[model samples]
Target: MAGSELTNIKSPRVKAARRLAKRAFRDRDRSFLAEGPQAVREALALEGVVAELFTTAEAELRHADILFAATHAGVPVFRVSGEVMSELAQTVTPQGLLAVCRFLHVPLEQAVTAGSRLVAVLAHVRDPGNAGTVLRSADAAGADSVVFTDASVDPYNGKCVRASAGSLFHLPVTVGTPAAQAVARLKESGLRVLAADGAGERTLDDVDLSGPTAWIFGNEAWGLPPELLRLADEVVKVPIYGRAESLNLATAAAVCLYASARSQRAGSESGPAPRLP
Candidate 1:
């Protein structure tokens, strides 16, 4: 078609972005779906590559600027109906906008320590939502990085990505089961591995969390893996007097990571803090 004819050509509905939302297709195509205005915006803002953009009519809701950016970036944008958007969307509620993006390969060694040299590890967490929520909190709590270890749920899952809001784009993330030797390596390198336990006698308030610490949270059902716990230098549990059973994995992670951040901020204000030999 000529340029003039192409201008008049119909925009598409239900394009490649919709198809890539499926798990199999995401793997086969090496692309994942990012939904909502914020998710799409972050994917666009990433210094990495965005494969394509699919904005349903309902999802786009006639947002012209978004269309302009998508076109300018050379990302293909298609229009899908409300029904089609729901069909392709992973969420129960379709936010009306979605994008297909290539996953950035995050390295474990490089992303380990951030502010206060504090880190959070998700050991053997299986739920995608919980994993994502933890990542979001880690980023919000000023953590330098997060490591999802063992058989944790795929952090790339749509729900997880969505749960993070836009934090996933900005934070450094590492996923893998590093050898036990590697865990020991981090300990020797100066990470105070503080595992959160329900039975831990030490209160979070008792421990000086201002040093380079790696706050490890265990599985939702079982808590931390024994090997990791055994390697930890300290263990602290949330003090709960209410009749509640236990904190959710993500909730526990937020509490621990923020506590570390809180302690460090206090220490910095008071002057140099002492470290354990």
Candidate 2:
């Protein structure tokens, strides 16, 4: 809306935005693409996060407030044709809006502090969608932070970013930290680490999650390895009441995180635990 339309996908600006689709380019540029109105809005809400915005004529008209906010914040805006939007957007159907935003990951040490009540650690989780869904769930459950270990998928992956549904901007995120190191630092911060595994000895119902807690979620296909499982204070399994096989990684994470959140909140209201007889 601020300048002439970008019709050519090969233009310098368009090319730069397209390059962000790859992890290498994103890392080198310290930016990634946020598609759809929700992602763009969330990115613009953060100071100095949105560098540039791209929108079709229809999108600009429909989301005038967003464009106005971007212009007010000194971010450049370009109107592009639907064809051009397709090239910039990853989805099968273009959302007609996209934004180039800075990376938002913090260091593990910064994310997990002394007062962290709930945290989610993604260990060797390869699927970007799953990782993003887990992050969204963590945010909903009032987690203090979300950590993507070195073996996990990139949090900036377009699929992951979109799957987060703008929750990526809601809480602290740590990327590329080794799982073991993350667990060690969380433990050092006084968090009781729990690993979510289907074959774990302890069930979620058995754990007292009133205190500070960090959950370690493993890969989808294969659960946490023995070494990683050993790092946790306890390995927990969500009890299966029905005939279902097992819950997916994202679903399991949501259940585990909410369990801790509910327990902690209830514990806070009920005073200290009664002494065991």
Candidate 3:
């Protein structure tokens, strides 16, 4: 494996890595930044994503296992100065690690039918952190894939990636898909699309989630509009048992996804989907 200790923050290589912080640059280059030891390690573990890795001298010493893994995988690992690492990292207190990774998203058509029994679709979500958390939750709940509608934040955004921790690289994610098209694809794949909202007449418990299902979570502020909600087979709400007005996007998503996962699993273990007469 090739390696070099770089100190110059103005180096062309350093500048190129920093450019990934911008959405336009990321889109143009078809790459993004994965920062910190955990994210970098995950990026290296996945095949054909970690193009190059940058680490500080201190990090090189502290995270020797990660460095060795990258080297074993034939990834180019560079030892950079603390300043250079900071410049590449989005966090204020850098973890002395960062990596240049190719885009991990797939097309909406490919993603919706990637043999996913349950999928989470975000419609017009704007917050990067919220989007990331939802992705992580979907992964945690054993969701097959996550899709971000065209109006949503970039799933590859630095903040979203950071919030996902290492889950970003764990599952299939689709971005820049329109809400209507995404819903149509999921439904065509035999998934019952359910829109999550606060005013739905049906609670999540009323739904039979054992069948293949796609759950659509709306934006942070406005939630799903009437038109988007109408695309779903049904509108469901998470029961608010407490004084809280409503659950946020991430929390609602987790609850909804987990319900489907558990129901599907139970149905599989006990009996198959019922057949019509």
Identify the leading candidate in terms of lDDT: 2
lDDT of 1: 0.72
| Models, CA RMSD each | 5.0, 2.5, 3.7
* lDDT of residue 251 for candidate 2: 96
- Candidate 1: which pairs clash? 13-79, 56-80, 59-96, 114-144, 218-223, 218-224, 219-223
TM-score of each: 0.83, 0.96, 0.93
lDDT of 2 at 59: 94
For candidate 2, write residues 169-244 as lDDT tens digits.
8899999999889999999999999999997876787778889999999999998999999889999999888999
Could you tell which candidate, 1 or 3, scores higher by TM-score? 3
Q: Each model's C-alpha lDDT?
A: 0.72, 0.92, 0.88
lDDT of 3 by residue, 70-135 (tens): 888888888888878877789999898889999989888778883669999988889999999999
What C-alpha lDDT, on a 0 to 100 scale, does residue 145 get in candidate 2?
97
Instruction: Find the 10 residues in a row with the least total lDDT in model 3.
Output: 268-277
What lDDT is reached at residue 271 by model 2? 36
Candidate 1 vs candidate 3: which has greater lDDT? Answer: 3
TM-score of 3: 0.93
lDDT of 2 at 236: 90
